[model samples]
Target: MPDSSAVHFTNAFDIRSVGCSGDPTMFEAFWRETGDAAELVIPGWQTMSYFSDVGNVCWFMEPLFDQQVRRLHRTVGNAAVDGYHVLVGTGSTQLFMAALYALSPADADQPTSVVSTAPYYSSYPAVTDFLRSGLFRWAGDANSFVGDSYIELVCSPNNPDGAIRDAVLSSGAGKAVHDLAYYWPQYTPITRRADHDIMLFTVSKSTGHAGTRIGWALVKDREVARRMTKFVELNTIGVSKDSQLRAAKVLGAVSDGYDVGGGGASRHRLFDFGRRKMVERWRMLREAAAASGAFSLPAETSGQCNFANETAANNPAFAWLRCDREDVEDCAGFLRGHKILTRSGNQFGADPRYVRVSMLDRDDAYDIFISRLASLK
Candidate 1:
């Protein structure tokens, strides 16, 4: 595997790719540093029981998982973990839907309107409407939403655009669920301790371990947590014990790196590693976008990072690119015609001139994307 630096490769897939969780191979060095310590040699009989422990509601969560989550939180000073119930899910997606279910009134006259600002995560509307559940339905932007009862899905820094955001609808009946998958120190500053009512995070974006299929939510309301937990129980009974264990080990390993003061050969801090890689990638992207006169990128966003002890800008998980040239009607289609695939801005409730390009591909593929984007007329 190549270093964390995006490896340069030649292929159709290389140019076609420009999207999420990143290539895990980038973490080859970091994982190898953990060595056999992360290895869990579970005997056949060990996991036969459904319970991971005696007192836990669901038995799959090892105590270490919760502890490490708190440890990492305190270490990074990103989001609050204390006074909150941490519920695990297959990924943030399950929790996202679960929050909507939990927030919507079951006995209401109609399903609660779920909404977010435009250029939102494309998946929000798709997932909410796909099941066509009676509990809640996908409502467009919160800005224009006139309803009194609603669940506002707030993604900060917002996906597709990476803009830091707050709940737009201030109605008394409105409740907000914060999708904080990209709120880590690597992508954005440890701005303030996020202590929202319901905040969702994923291991995928945090550590580039998207395949683990593990995510967690921090909920303040016990009843809300109970309902969300019930939703998971009905959806899949519970999350994967194996995956949770692996995630615990991975997260613990990440914490250990930072705990050791981040230096020398062994203590390679995960956040530091991730932040550096992202900043460099963003620099390359900006240059590429600048070279291409037909395209425009979002203005850089920076703030004082408490973790890094320096001012840092957001190097978001994805790049929101706008086609500035008059010739391009649908930016995504234009890129696709040029052998590149991107999520169109319209999917996020924006115009056809906008496109979301993933910044998580391996270095080689990213290099190709930048080159192709720069050369595109």
Candidate 2:
């Protein structure tokens, strides 16, 4: 009733999508800083690596598959699940489609209503539309469902705005699938309880290996897991075992404390460091934006949306700011001219005054952003 359908452009600055945020781990600089000068070991392994050529699976599949799944298990708290299946796609975007197919019915009378919380991952509706002709409807308000819906896709530390809500798993009529694409230690503290039976994760956010095009799902219900496996089969037969192994190697290294996301002592240490940096950067960005007095952000510099119970985010990687000023019609272009590329909030079903800002980047980048915004005043 509050006209929640409209989103603003400034809200885009609040998310860490690819390229914009610039993951240090993914960059060569990160490895250089770690003093690992070796030129990618794994002699015969990488040569035989069919992660790119997933369709070309040979005898090296099974063992590689085992190694990868185990590594993933260890990384994600080692939850229990039988029948290890791996499917590699171009990116987690493909996996998102696979998840939808696994849940939606082909011949159901009511086009399965796909519901995700407000200010969710921007890709949810896009993927759903491309995958299913049926279309995904957004669910507004935490407690109140937008419409009568069954399948719910919720993102922890949601995109556009890092709002991590307390969602539970209730079987039968109410089912929830978690899009935990950003559940890595560097982005946010790992506090999500595996108490739920169904969940999903992507290598892009966790490993900074978005190019690998690999991701996996964790489900408690044996039947649901089986169906999901079947969905993978239908999508592309199976994920590349080579990618699985590679991911496994990296995950193993992470579990063994060999290669952490932020290269800090523990995942917590990495998270804390990122939190501090994000807070420092946000302080400057917020101040600059505040000078205009046209933007609104989370109460705490921590970027925690208390409404979503996103307490774990001491400081969100991005800043979700809203511009309530009556003058500006286009916030995205306004920032783009200043060389600050951000997403428009309309895509998130929010007001036009909102724009998202990625706070997790080099200090220099943040400084430039603040300087640009300050110039606007």
Candidate 3:
């Protein structure tokens, strides 16, 4: 198999690949400007308490990190964190599992079903079912399921396809968890403030710092917050104090870029930089797709962006591409044959005609992808 598992740099950075990696070029410049803002000497004796709070909800979460989270939300105007308890995790994935644990009926004898709409994040089924947890089980698509004792995951500005979504099951017994990972201004318009009982956010998507592994949840109920915290406590004991500290600094820098906007070398803000790159990449992708006549893409949508102070459209993180040629049975496999890599639609519980392509790779890989795609007959 030519060691396809590993990336081999031959003639170019391969565009045939995974779901992530938005260009980090701007983030590099951001750090060069703001890296020193939250310097921590980490005295060997500090954070030895193994706790940031006794309550366990924010146990390993640094207080300053908490403050920065609040400040950043205020600056962005995307989410409302006031009166909401923040639960920190290694990443939103942990918080997601914790939400399932908290929402599932503790008294139920059988596992409570957890679900989302079709074309859900590909990993949800595997992650939810992996444990076969007595507390919860992965039930596909909320639209089909007719049972109670269910927890619905709502990924606004959803994965695989970028459509905004809400709880379809409206059953009195169903509880909804909003995954707002891509609700930030860079990916979508901040049309309104989200005040959900359980909401997840991640630095990986928000600020292009996936390697840091820091994510948080906003909980409206104290009991649910406590339960989610207990799951986190048992899962990792506590999130890394070091990571929390670094994230606080990075988040603070992001807020600064938004708040204190002045022209020149220091003018680059995280969201602005990300939005610009994404907009340009989307334009090019659309152009290539139209030229190819071999592929079809999602319809474009636009709205009034409250944060950007102008009308704008959503720029999805991943491109949901479908092969236009009826001869192609599987879009992902067809792309593979063309030396392009893509995730199959079946992973998201969709048909084989559709595939998912990351629109966030570097220039060379993206250019190669566009050229090859446009050349397709």
Evaluate all candidate structures by whole-model CA lDDT and list the values in order: 0.82, 0.56, 0.82
Task: Name model 1 segments beyond 4 Å from true.
Answer: 1-16, 20-29, 32-34, 57-59, 261-266
**Candidate 2 lDDT over residue span 1-377, tens digit each:** 24443333334443322124434332222334433322235556454542333342212234543455555555554233354344344355665665666666666676666666666666677766654466344344334554444677777767768776556333466567777666554555555444445656666666455555677665555555556656566667666655665666555444544335546433322233444565566678678877866666876624433222455444555677776656776677667766777777777767656777766555555676677766673
The number of clashing residue pairs in each candidate reads 7, 27, 2
Clashing pairs in 1: 6-363, 7-363, 7-364, 8-364, 18-358, 19-358, 52-59
Summarize candidate 3's per-residue lDDT along 1-377 as a digit string, tens digits.
37653445442355433323343333454455655654557778776777787754667778988888888888888889989999898988899998999998889988998889989998789889998898898989888898876999999999879998887887787899999989998888999988988999998788877778899999999999989988988999989888888888888877877675542224547788778888998999999998999988999898889889999889998889999898998998888787788888899989889988877665666778778888887
The TM-score values for the models, in the order shown, are: 0.92, 0.72, 0.91
How many times do residue backbones clash in model 2? Answer: 27
Q: What is the lDDT of residue 7 in candidate 1?
A: 50
Clashing pairs in model 3, backbone N/Cα/C closer than 3 A: 16-341, 52-59
Model 1 agreement with the true structure over 316-356: per-residue lDDT tens digits: 88889999989789998988887677888888899989998
Q: Candidate 1's error at 332, in angstroms?
A: 1.1
Stretches of model 2 off by over 4 angstroms after superposition? 1-28, 35-90, 131-149, 168-171, 258-276, 291-293, 301-313, 361-364
